[model samples]
Target chain A: MKPLPRIVSVLSAALIIAAAIGFLDAAYLAAKYFTGGPIACSVLDGCDTVTKSAYAVPAGIPVAVLGVMFYASVLVLALVFRERRSVTIARLLAIAGAIGFLASVWLVSVQVFILDALCLYCILSAGSSTAIFILGIAVWRLAVARANASDAAGHDSTAGRLPAVGNK
Target chain B: MSKSSIAILGVVVLAAAGLVYLGIAADGGPAAGGQAAIMTAEDHVKGNREAMVVLVEYSDFQCPACAAYYPLVKKIAEDYANDVAIVYRHFPLQQHRQAVAAAQAAEAAANQGRFWEMHDMLFEHQGEWSGNANAAELFAGYAAAIGLDGDQYRRDVEASAGRDRAQEDFQSGRAAGVNATPTFFLNGQRIVGPQSYSEFAALLDEAIAQNR
Candidate 1:
């Protein structure tokens, strides 16, 4: 019911969206490997270039495998939270999501600028992560509000009155 | 905000999440779209067990490119023998005069379960058999050199069955988008031109990891 909780819920939804993108990328890779068909990549020779590139696989596993892990982790971070710790947890999740989003963006840049190709799924994953990061920042602001409210309410004796960025 | 407000937010978030999932699952996505042509030599593969990797080669015995690639392909085949299945498909170009005939001879040997042996012999004496002058004599000698039933080989070479098989292989290569000699398909993905052993090994490693 609190503002912080509402913001956390929104971020959780965004995290799920990113995870969905990751799942789709993984599924497409699976289908291409087994069926021997043209992988409909978004960019020119996207499928061929990306799949054939040495960077496509890391540690003997497809890069999509790692995308799925990162997205799922973000989703879990968003979904699991106690109202008492909602503010702190949401902030932590947002910071992590931003880091992940930047990483994805870097990868997409490499794919396009260096590889001279675009992988649709990679684009989607990067775009979704960026969205989640923005949503996460909003959640972090709400957490700052919650912390400020708790301090003002005399609920936490050890805390000082913090800056009021927004109503909790 | 009340408990009802919280409940409404939860419902919206969950619904949006479901929609996101549906959007992603709507199509098979980018990775499963292109269809690479499968080579016909895939049929001659009598080995029951599925190989870890199939090296489908489009080769012309008399073509210089084919001759150049011969050693690399041989090295790859030997290095990855049990793990990789090598399917040689004839891709005799019109420029190469005796390539079709050489391919026919190889096919005839294949019928007698000596396809690979005859294949090696053809590559070994590419210069002598590649010319029109002594092709038959050189081919017959190769048949004898490989300990084939020389008389039957001569008959089979003249039968047109061997020639037909070679034509079929050439057609298959064309269908698979082979424009030049020594085009290779490693597990159905075309790996163009002659590359180092390490390159082939690396690609094969990726294919095996994918299979696992």
Candidate 2:
């Protein structure tokens, strides 16, 4: 089997790591929300306030649960498509990342303005989502580049050149 | 990096900056052009009316955070009985299915001069009725438990007066930049969420000292 391109491997690694961070951050918040315990805030000292705020839950569902689901989905997709250079998978990653990014934007805004409190865990989760989104965009670009390179090489030589397309 | 990579980085930076700006703009502080109205005699009051410090809370009864802060806030009121005045306002969020109903129940109780009793009962038993399909029935039970006239309570719950009162509080909250509960205005400065009693006491102390 051909080895993965350096760029794809790096991007996949970053995405997985970022998604894992997001999942853990969200999981902690979900646990705190359900168990009725205070969230320990080291940096900003408002995790409890922000997490317990009205905006913390949307549509009666915990935002942390939603965050967990989002990160878990992204993690699964990244692993499932690890071996293949599927453009569809790349697009899916981009879409998921974009959604997470936008959500981070809204949540951060709520923390800054409405809640008047900053949650360290929330900020960490937002950072992870932002990282995943940036990586997702890079991966998509890489996929597009590979596709273009393959088309230029044509069908006969494309298979042989596939592994080398995105390495440089 | 390639030119395309540079371009992507530029776009990312711009997007991040834009989002940060939006977040700052969205910060729900008092709206532009008008100051929120001050609490009046019509508002429900707890503790000493002659207190130098006034802490007005805009709360949704069904909010879990509000329930969590209930004991802490009640304790504060007790501790600063003579030094601070606590005012309760209804700001039922649209999200909580039972919030408005609970607010109305408290309003209904207000008519019978038992608002604080109902408020305490609702927050204490919040988990029991917050998600129940028969929340209205549960609230009615609470009204009766708090010594309100049953028939009068039921009628007031359905009355526009209760709803209108809640709406007025919500509008004032919005006008004052309240985006979440349980939001507290300590002498007109906003403090959001469940804060420690010590923190609250400190703020209260500061207000008292400032007044001196």
- Predicted structure with the largest TM-score when compared to the true one: 2
Query: Individual DockQ of the candidates?
Result: 0.02, 0.08
Interface RMSD score of each model: 14.4, 10.8
- Error of model 1, residue A83, in angstroms: 91
DockQ of 2: 0.08
TM-scores of the first chain across all predictions? 0.71, 0.86
Misplaced by over 4 Å in model 1 are A1-168, B1-49
- lDDT (10s digit) by residue, model 1, range A81-128: 322335666677788778878878777877755654455566777787
True-structure RMSD, every candidate? 16.3, 10.1
Residue-pair clashes per candidate: 6, 2
Fraction of true inter-chain Cα contacts (below 8 Å) kept per model? Answer: 0.00, 0.00
